[model samples]
Target: MKRRQIYFILVLIACNFTLGYAQNPFEVIEEPLPYSKKASSFTINIIGYNEDFVINEWQKYITDFSGLTYVTAVNKGVVEMESSGVVFPLLNDNKVNLYTRFAPNKTLTGVLLTVWVQKSDGTFFSSESSKKEAERIKDWLFEFQDKIRLLNTRIKYQQRF
Candidate 1:
């Protein structure tokens, strides 16, 4: 009876661990091309907002960017944005993929936003090419983060008022 009870407890613990791992939304799959091979990725969590709201805001921001043009929703939480023309000599055309994962809980209430860039061929820019274009990508991401922060602040302030 004692051995049986111990085995049962061990099985329960193992099952719990497996379920927790499976439910993690932020687990980055390295085998995927764009996700693991991205030249750069910016991840952030915006509190007090749902996944749909976060995705909508990102869509609006990307559409409003000077060179970026809204293409179409790849899926429910994934959006694809393309450049209007050749933005970089090395990468004739570039594309941005925005992926959002929402996790709402008592402590944290928001979505995880990941921005990835790829070349026209649907692969990450080479290291040499990325070195040349890093500055531009960094600048754009900085501006994008600032806009998100401002939007979050406004939402929180309005909620209080």
Candidate 2:
């Protein structure tokens, strides 16, 4: 009787472990959403030239970003982007966007891309899409980066002056 009980207990434990460690379907086969991870607690938004497209269409092009791991859902793609240091905010819009462009490595239009992190937290951090209110999420991403670059240049000029 004791031997049977022990066997049953072991089997139950094994089943429990399997269930707990089962692979997540999203991680296994889904394309990650286009977003950049600068580091812990930081993400950037990416944008493309032809920004508007069906959500499904977006899924087809996730491979453009080599550093990011992407997973696709019914409508949105989740991305696990690679980063080494702290992530800085590039934009202040609410939602993050991923954009693609030409890449030398790959023979695809809009093959290369970049990301920007919007900053519309408004006191509380909410994961809501703010694309509607801000019509040009893609343009904003570039403009935001340009502004950062310009600011850096001005700082350097001032230091030299």
Q: Best candidate per lDDT, number?
A: 1
**Candidate that would win on TM-score:** 1
Local accuracy of candidate 2 as per-residue lDDT tens digits, 1-161: 99999999999999998977752211111122345322112122222222233122333323232223233221222232322121223233223333232122122222123333324332211123433322343443345435544655786899998
- Clashes found in each candidate (C-alpha, N, C closer than 3 A): 0, 25
Instruction: Assess the local accuracy of residue 134 in candidate 2 as a C-alpha lDDT between 0 and 100.
Output: 29
TM-score of 1: 0.45
lDDT of each: 0.53, 0.34
Span of 10 residues, lowest total lDDT, candidate 2: 23-32
